[model samples]
Target: MEGVIDGDTRALLSEDGALDWCVTEFVRVVDARLPPRVFLRHCPELATAGSAGPITPSATPVTLQLLGSDPRGLAANAEQAISQGVTRLDLNFGCPAKTVNRHDGGASLLRTPERVYTVVGAVAEVSQRHGVSVNAKLRLGFDDKQLALACAQAAEAGGAEELVVHARTRREGYRPPAHWEWIARIRAGVRVPVVANGDIWSLEDYWKARTLSGCRDVMLGRGMLADPWLARRIRHWLETGGERLSPTPWSARSDMLIRYADAKRDAGMAEKVIVSLLKQWLNIMRGRDSEAAARFTALRRETALAPFVAGLSDLGSSSDSTSSGTAAHASSTLAG
Candidate 1:
């Protein structure tokens, strides 16, 4: 999601006005504070932010996410982001990438909940002065669920106003059966509100996740990518007493992809790079839509932007998407 869910993607998805907020991809922090450009690059919305800080064109709040192990450095960068008009912050300890872990970031910190406390405490200290709340995203654990509750409590104790639990251990990767029940355990154990995340791909999944975890809210990830209207769909169901919107047609999805390409082209992105970006989004959509699956199969190996964009106009499906290729950043899946 670090590469996949940048500012443009956030705008497109949040434009429906169904989502409460969106998160920028994690800003990788090491020992030293980063410059304002780093934060802006990850969240271009900041450049045009209103008094409430950076938000999507539809006004959904965008939370700036930081992935790192250094507390003092994270604190300094948190202050830097605050200066740049970021009103919200989230610490990511759920990413399962080996390189991130080996570098002493992400889920690797879950192995010792104490470290979670220290890191979050440092950032919270900075954010509190600005009257901004800090939140944390977490996985079950590095290797198992033993430390899940401990980590949740650690984050809350360190002043996280909310906790988002992506219900799998680092070892589970993105495998299915996301263990929503485990989130229930963590929710019961923490004082701060816990938002259920991971594998809520449809209305049924959302209900199951909320019912199991007893959480009032959820964080959507790949599922939202797979179905751009998912948030709206869920919102409709909730508002209309179980009324179901018609399933997304492939044509709609295609139109969205084409519009994304048009935006990139307007910004002078390379045609070849746009081709790859289209493929990455299609790759995610194929997982949950049968029509998307067929189109992905047809266009899987296509390299030309023209052919790829043309292929999205299939007769069967309808909708709207983009990506950047930084492999480590690419694998940085948050929430789900």
Candidate 2:
């Protein structure tokens, strides 16, 4: 969500009461020396700009997530992040980027439980020393589930406060059916709180995943990207029954795009940056209907933001009456 869910985008979501907790994109830990501003910039959720108020309230407690293979470097960076007011620490073992895996940063660590233990141990030591919670998000395995239980158990032994298990192997991209049942096995195997991830896109999906995983907490990814109101809907359905939150109106969508544009403008982003962000947003908005899909496809072809958002505004206004603003069913069609 780096290029997409930055301060401006998150601020837009927050205005709509969509997102709760937001994590910064992984600041790859390459060495021990990390600048203080880097933490503030990347974890902007902890800064005033990320907060609800103009400069007083923080955006959200942005967890500084780091990805690397070295325990010493991870621990050192974790220390610096804590000193910079990072509320939480997340170790990434699920990213499937080619460069990341080539450098053994993301899913590569899943291949070695010993390494996961060592890295988790170092970070956990720093987390406990600083009184900050440390968590890990992992794929089931690089190639199989046999190592998943071992990898999960090792993280627990190494002092991870919580674990979010994505129920698919690394080979599986955002394809079809996710292996939700595997979360059940991992939960039974670990002592720490286990958050079920992968394939949860709607309220029914939430209940089904909970039943399959035997767990309550879940971490949504692509589903949330597709339907920004997913978590809010899940929260609403859990508190009530059959009551669905409506989508943000067309006027609100127009306002959101304008506000996001202004935030990006203040951030000193290039024109291309604004275009890219709006294009990604259109892709997410495409989850609505065929008209939105065509509009997003058209928007992606352009090299501007103003026109793209305007087109989206038009499409949103037309679809508000016919389209389900939030998810109508619980499914993981956006799963990857």
Candidate 3:
């Protein structure tokens, strides 16, 4: 979720109650300890109550995520972030990016469970003094799934309050059919809560994952991006046993994009960057919605935020134009 789940995206998702909590994109730890400003840069929510921000219609607390191999440096930075009012810290051991692994960060640490233990232990020990919670997010293993049990044990022994298992090895690289049974095995081996993650794109997928992983908690990443109402739908289904629901219509989805753009603009992101982010979101949505694909095809080249907003406005207005009367009314109701 590095280049993807920024503050704006988090706000958009949180506004609709899509997440109970969010971890900011990884703040890299090198030889030197990072400053408080670096944490603020990644998660501006640290400036708010309970390290929370107004997620539009609602608010959700965000935890600071750190990625690195150096236990001391990570501990120091985690301490600084905690001192700056970050109430929770999540260590990133699941990122599969080649650049990050090459630099001895991310999933490469999985090759050595002791390093994971040391790093998590160091950070947890520091945060525990301040009554802050520490957690770890991990893949099954580096290239082999057999190491997952030991990895979970390491994280627990190192004082992680909870563990999130992404149920895929680094080599798997987001392939179809995430192995959630591996998460079940890890959950059985560890005493801490194991939150299941990976390949959950719908309510059905959520139920399937919960059954396979034997986990009550689940985390959504790309799935949430593909369908903004996914979490809300899942919550409703869990409460009401409803039938599968369709995605939000084009007009309503367009309003979310507009709101995201306005939030970014208000935060002082340049027009070009805001436009690029909008296009990125649209591209992701295009895979699931034909209208989004059509709109992205029409405005992918736009370099200014004004034109992008105008294009979205046109897309929203015309969404019902090509539909039957009944469909047009449904779209109008959704927009309203």
Q: What's the CA error at residue 278 for candidate 1, in Å?
A: 1.0
lDDT of 3 by residue, 1-336 (tens): 556687667777776554677778889998587777787778877666453431223566677789999989998998888778888789999999999999999999999899899999999999999888899989999999878889889999999999988989999988978999989999999999989899887777888999999998888887777777777777655655464445567876687889888888897889998888788878878887888888999998889889789888774444433211111000000000
lDDT of each: 0.84, 0.71, 0.79
lDDT of 2 by residue, 135-168 (tens): 8888889877789999999889999998878888
Residue 180's lDDT within candidate 1 is 92
Off-target runs (Cα >4 Å) in candidate 2 are 16-20, 48-59, 246-255, 315-317, 322-336
Q: Which candidate is the best by lDDT?
A: 1
Q: Give the alpha carbon lDDT tens digit for every residue of 1-336 in model 1.
A: 645687778878777678888888888899898988999999899999878989888787889999999999999999999999999999999999999999999999999999999999999999999998899999999889999999999999999999989989999988988999999999888889889899878878888988998888888998888887778777777776677777776766777788888888888989988888888988899989887888889988988888788888655433322221111101112231
Taking all chains together, the TM-score of candidate 3 against the true structure is: 0.89
TM accuracy, model 1:
0.93
lDDT of 2 at 213: 90
The C-alpha TM-scores of every prediction are 0.93, 0.87, 0.89
Question: Which of the two, 1 or 2, has more lDDT?
Answer: 1
Worst 10 residues of 1 by lDDT: 323-332
Q: Against the true structure, candidate 2 has what lDDT?
A: 0.71
